[model samples]
Target: MTAHLITGAGSGIGAAVSARLAERGDELWLLARDAGRARELENRFPVARTIVGDLAAPDKLSWALSHQELPDRLDSLLHIAGVVELGEVGELTPKAWNLQLAANLVAPAELTRLMLPGLRAARGQVIFVNSGAGLHAGAQWAAYAASKHGLKALADALRLEEHDNGVRVTSVYPGRTATPMQVKVHQQEGKEYDASRWIDPESVATTILAALDLPRDAEITDVSVRPGR
Candidate 1:
């Protein structure tokens, strides 16, 4: 069975991807912020394993993972967990910027650095679940957009850096997927939530799986998922 580690497997796109992979008998390793969350993930994915590493504290991820056992070789590392807080340039505080940057950008980079051995061993793939904001920043989305943009840069650099090692990197940019994150974004925008109008989480999952399942002879670098309706 191919083994993979996933962050943010609790809900939304992360949950959707986990469910799909689990159904196919893939060995899963889920990341949780704490022991309680690890328990929750274990319950959710009965056959999978769990690791406790708080993305909020990116600087401490090395220390935390040092105490735990990680996979010797991983087929993939999915960077799916992220936090978002919307505010304009003048209104967004340092706390908000740091929160988004730490979780979405710094944490992923640190985790990737720590997992390079396994990734290199298996010639793994790194998938970043980015947002459309990563490509284009609009009004009042400064901090979140900036973090995502940085994530894009990270992916780009990693793809080239790891090319000779046979590790692939892909960034999937989804447009307004109907997940809890979308609901929160709507709440922040002070708009009514309607799940029907946006792209489905499963759609994004399918996109991710396609990238993962591509033939070794070719690799997909970037994918953009937009709402069809």
Candidate 2:
């Protein structure tokens, strides 16, 4: 069975992807903020292990992964943990901007750095869960957009740097998925939450699985998924 480490595995696209992988009998190491939710996955899948903590803090993240006794080499590292703080440039504070950068960009970079050797050993894949916000800036999405764009840049850099090492890096941009984060974004806009209008998290997870399923000789450098109107 393939061994994979997934962050933000408690809910949303993270949880959906975990479920899909379970069906295929993958060994999973799940990192989530909620211990309860992570443990729930352990109950559902015999191959699942739980690591509960804040992914944004390198120390906490490192501690959790170390304590969990993960496989020495991972087949894939799926980074799905992120924070979205929406605000116009003028309204955005240093704290808000920095938090978004740390969680959405820096955290993933740090985790990937820590996991690089194992990924290299296994010739593994790294998938960054980015957003359409990375591609275009909206009236009140400057901070979030900036962070995601940085994530895209990070992925590109990693892909080039690790290509010779046989590690594949992919950045996936999903547009307005129907996740709890979207509910928060909608509430900030004072708009009624409409789940039907947004892309399903499972849809995004399926795309990720596709990227992971590719032949060793083939690489999908980038993927963009948007809901049908």
Candidate number of the best TM-score: 1
Query: After aligning candidate 2 to the native by TM-score, how far in Å is the CA of 71 from where it should be?
Result: 1.6
Model 2: residues >4 Å from true position, as ranges?
A: 34-37, 43-46
What tens digits encode model 1's per-residue C-alpha lDDT throughout 174-203? 999898988999999999999999999999
Tens-place lDDT digits, model 2, residues 1-229: 6889998776789989999998888888887666777677677666788767675575567766676665689899999988887777888899998888888888888889878988999999999999998888899998889999999999999999999999999999999999999999999998999999999999999999999999998999998999996
> Which whole-number lDDT from 0 to 100 does residue 175 have in model 1?
95
lDDT of each: 0.96, 0.87
State candidate 1's TM-score.
0.99
Provide the lDDT at 199 for model 1.
93
- Model 2 residue 109 CA deviation (Å) reads 0.3
